[model samples]
Target: MMLAGYLVAVLAGLFAVVAIYAMLSSLPNAPDYFSVVGVSPIAALLVPPLGMFIYFLTIVLTGMQTLVFALIAEFFSLRNALLHMMFGAIAAVAGFALIWPGASENPERWADMGIIGTAGVVAGLVYWLIAGRDAGFRRPLFERA
Candidate 1:
């Protein structure tokens, strides 16, 4: 269970990294900041091979996060966090590929991306919901699940 938790955090972190990198790469000027009904500071680090590092880190961090949650959910009884993380990551990666930025303008692509995104979110939520409660995290779903 301890190992599983570590894996989940690592994987979740990795996912964040990739998502951030993709988002940043798609934008211009390494954007100092951006907003979506609210303001957020943009990352400006200049890590070489930033894309590749992000990709790897995302895989690791997200895995760790997922594992940690899954283990907690199973009362430190389950030992399959790696499997859960792998499958969930697969779903997310597929969503990312299908709903890439270019698809924003293409109706078909946009629709596909939406579907994929929804799938990824649902899968992730399911894992987290179960894990959180099992682990006694007891926090309300931040975004209504």
Candidate 2:
């Protein structure tokens, strides 16, 4: 269930990135969309969501392992938003690094790295917003609570 929520949030972020890219690519001065986007928009629209599922699954598994280790050492604590932000930063760097080698081959594609990194950060933030809150965190429906 949590994964579903995270998936929705990430997909929404990805859509926003694609929409922005599409708009920017249409500008007369903009570089070719294929070079900037690194893939056809059709593929761009389809690939990340699928890739993210795998990527996020890896994150979850690694987090679980870390949690288990922390628990064994009595160092575990409730989830923190700052920690989520840290994860977001890490994801952004990792995403950018993964594409850097290929992007370096073409000067035009270098600009796309920024766009891809931005998208990664957005996806991370969306995931954090959807799922990073601690169990004790709550919001009241009325202001007078």
Candidate 3:
């Protein structure tokens, strides 16, 4: 059950990242694929055929950070909402760093990073709600066995 919960938490965070990325990227001046050329933003989200690639790619990229944070949280038995949020933000920033090397050095890239970080924050909150509340609960016996 713990493993299942952890998986769910990670999945929730990844989805949150994809969602925020889609929403923010749909704004004016974003990439052509994200922009609503002949369709409404709502419609674009509803029919995210192109965005599917981005969604999967983000999950693959950010999954590592999420797993790392999960290990730390589990090891420390952390359940604080703020800490989880921070973890989320940090994971998102790490993913952004990987995707856009040197983008952080530029002022314009800061905005995009900010968006990713924001997504991570929300994802963290979601994770806390799901599994952080009972982090490492009653698991010592399993280790012994």
Candidate 4:
């Protein structure tokens, strides 16, 4: 169930980003959802689900980063949101860099950064909704206070 929820959230985020990108670019508004589903298996054969895994890991790590900042840096929730946004932007750029190296010089790269960052923000919001607005880290491996 947890995995299913995460998958759905990630896919939804991806589709939302694609849609927004299309709209902003004044390109065709049609989103080929079937293409994504159809290509997953072939793409996985090349990188073994690397894209999906990276997105999931990025979301989880961003949440952990947010928690760390909130706890150690005494950051407010707003600051936490900013931190997550920054992380998302960096992650998206870095992911693109790893995949396409010098493609950063392209104008479209900036647009992609915007889309991916927005997706990250959306994912974070969804996660917070599911996990709770005031959720905090807990340590089951350690003795109770």
Top TM-score hit: 3
Model 2 scores a TM of: 0.51
TM-score of each: 0.28, 0.51, 0.68, 0.46
The candidate 4 region of ten consecutive residues with least summed lDDT is 70-79
lDDT by residue (21-88, candidate 4, tens digit) is 54554545524543454345456458967867856665554444444433432234333544434543
Compared with the true structure, what per-residue lDDT tens digits does model 1 show for residues 18-99? Answer: 4554464456664333222011112323544664564455444345444444555455443353444454555554535543
> Could you tell me which residue pairs clash in candidate 4?
none
Better of 1 and 3 by lDDT: 3
- Model 3 gets an lDDT of 0.72
Clashing pairs in 3: none
lDDT tens digits by residue: candidate 3, 35-66: 33224435547778755655567667778888
Q: Which residue runs of candidate 1 sit more than 4 Å off their true CA positions?
A: 1-99, 134-145
Q: 115 in model 4: Cα distance from truth in Å?
A: 2.0
lDDT, candidate 2, at 63: 45
Selected candidate, larger TM-score, 2 vs 3 = 3
Best by lDDT: 3
Over 4 Å off, model 4: 1-8, 27-86, 132-134, 138-145
Query: Model 2 over residues 1-145: C-alpha lDDT tens digits?
Result: 2455345545654555576687777778787653464344466348878666645653553344333322422233335655554454455445555646576677776666566556655655565566555222344467663
